[model samples]
Target chain A: MLNIGGLNQGVVIDHIKAGGAMKIYEYLNLEKQDCSVAIIKNAKSSKMGKKDIIKIEGPITVDLDMLGVLDPDLTLDIIEDGKITAKRNPRLPAQVTGIIRCKNPRCITSTEQELPHRFRLTNKEKGLYRCIYCEQAYKR
Target chain B: MKHVISPLDLSMEELDKVLSLAESILQDPEKYSECCHGKKLATLFYEPSTRTRLSFEAAMLNLGGSVLGFSSADSSSAAKGESVADTIRVVSSYADICAMRHPKEGAPYVASIHSGIPVINAGDGGHNHPTQTLTDLFTIKTLKGRLDHLTIGFCGDLKFGRTVHSLINAMVRYPGSRFILISPDELRIPTYLREEVLEAGNIPYQESKVLEDVMPKLDILYMTRVQKERFFNEEDYIRLKDSFILDAAKMQCAGKDMLVLHPLPRVNEIATEVDDDPRAVYFRQAQLGVYVRMALIMTLLGISAG
Candidate 1:
């Protein structure tokens, strides 16, 4: 029953898998920013055995599609004036650019550090993304 | 500019453009040496692929470009916990063009989206081997004098053989060509290939386990190793092992003009007796790889090697 008092307004990513809050924080780069964020871990849930919740103060831009990949089971709720204003369930992007690594060691992307890892969504339900360069598939 | 990611992305005209450029470079090597002057080509190989790396390096050196990149992932930044994206982002700054090899499927596809210059997939886990396909095409064009109406037999490991798959896909677009798949029961070509390439294209094909039985019918005998690693059981490897070997005895059954090609680093699959056979074209296949790559680099970089 960990609860942070309040926040001005922003997004509340709820129903995150337990202990995944820190990953979300790191992924979002919460510490380096000036905006305030409250992360609650090990919160009891009826659907999920245990979950984590994140409350962000201010309308921080987050790539929801990537969040879907990082934690597919997450529920994002935009809060305004202490009330849930909007709900979003963004699907994983059809093509991911500059995120995720190509696991193929033979692919040129594996060596070139300046290139962004790009993949096209080949199978959405399977979470499979194929590399445009190497045709390597990444499932998140 | 240096990397070749996919064959589908390259049109037929583009393929022809590359092939023609490669032809010119093959005809005149000294003229293209300064084409890549003061440029660097990096190859980051996460897998053990000596053939692809050597060809890439040879292509660059022949074009007056310097080559630098790791051949194994254990010696690279991947061991330092860096993602493939980060590595490419860094390397793109160092090299003008890059080639990569990885075990993970579609690794280069991911790299290409992020790559600043160009990313070439040397090979990904059983996914696609475009360069090898290009080399095979170039070899066929050079030796056979045409890309159409030839019957090619793919022997040995067809199940996980990327080169065989790519060649099959690329060749079907032409007229009068057919495939004779020779493999053990366990290493049969996948259904997707049958349904997608052969059936869809309505290309005639036959399946067999005996190489000698079908040798005379084939204009090109493309042999791939039935690798021991591909077998689940040791007994299976031992049992079907001798069936795929291309020795002098087997070559006797093949047509005199029937060229033998292999995407190689062969162990015992191709016997030493066959190497001296004038019909044996595996070494020539390897040599053609550089020319094909030269063609690919020139085409992708939007420059004619002329």
Candidate 2:
């Protein structure tokens, strides 16, 4: 068993479903940023069938709201000086500016490449967003 | 007020106001010229309903407004990962008003929340097509001389026919109007509609499998496409499709003054031979789309469409 050394400062996104770790990485844009990140896939977990954990060493800005979109069940633990300090289940944003594509095949956003496909937060209580052009809703 | 998101949101007075304005525009086309001059109407169609989109653009142009926007999400930044709220916020800044057609159930309702300008829903998935309802209302009022006390038969794909649903919703408001629903057993009107709308309204209605049998009793026959897609079996489609097609032979059984209505893009649902009939009102119905939308735009903008 390989043990991850205590991080001086960073976040550990744990209990992510094993296969869904890549999605989490893409959601956080982890590959593009300057940080030491380790993605451990197929780790043993009593609570989850097969869990994947993301260890980000050094402070890296992560949009937790988007992370919520990828995996709402993810739990984030911010580590500082090798001790768990802050824990958060970041609420998904009610309105996301640019994330999901409008599924309407005939929406203006479908034809005009220059135009932005917009959606509004409809039921924030349920983390729902609807397309501005087509009226499609997404629950995060 | 910048959009026609749903029919129920429009009060009877508001609906009548638009209809009356449409009548004025029809009476004097030139009087309404430049109603949207130097402005633009953006049609953001996320689905393929060329007929509806063209009607909207034509309405805007006839009122002296230019048109912009795309017909699908695939051709826009939406494919590149933009959101609907951002799209409308940006489009609203550019266009005076927008007509949107989407494949989702409540897309326009979502758009209207963040949109600065009016956002009319051309069609939203299988949910609603309110503008078509307005057009139907306008046509019935114009041709039949009244929307009240008429026997309107909604024939064919009532299950998925947004137009039929919307028209039925609009007509149920008036007194003395009854519905004769004609469709195959497989494609009957949905139960929620029957329960929540028809039965709740306590409107008199009859259901039958034959069109000709009910023809003589109808003041208006609204025909909808019998979608081949709705059937799971080829045999069932072949069995029920011909039952709904409105043919010249069927017209002989109809009243002399009875109007035949269709939300256009007809696919042999009404035989071409029947188009020559004076009572065939589908083309007239299609033309009314412009007038009704003209009225709708001006009403939403608080301008006199006339």
Best by TM-score: 1
Candidate 1 at residue B273, lDDT? 87
How well is each residue in B1-306 modelled by candidate 1, as lDDT tens digits?
445666555678878878878888888889998788788888989877888999999998998889999988899988887777778899989987888888866667677767887887788777777888899999999888899999999999999888898899899878999899999999999886897579977899999999999999999999998889888899999999999999999999999899999998888899998899989999998998898887776666666554
Q: Quality of candidate 1's docking, in CAPRI categories?
A: incorrect
lDDT of 2 by residue, B104-124 (tens): 656677688789998888888
How many Å off is the CA of B48 in candidate 2?
2.5
lDDT of 2 by residue, A1-140 (tens): 86878788889998887887887777678888788889999998889888998999876775666676556667899999989998887577666666666776655466446556666766545556677655556533
DockQ for every model comes to 0.19, 0.09
Candidate 2 stretches greater than 4 Å from native? A1-140
Candidate 2, position A95, lDDT = 64
TM-score of chain B of each: 0.96, 0.97
- Native A-B contacts reproduced, model 1: 0.41
What are the lDDT figures for the candidates, one per model? 0.83, 0.83
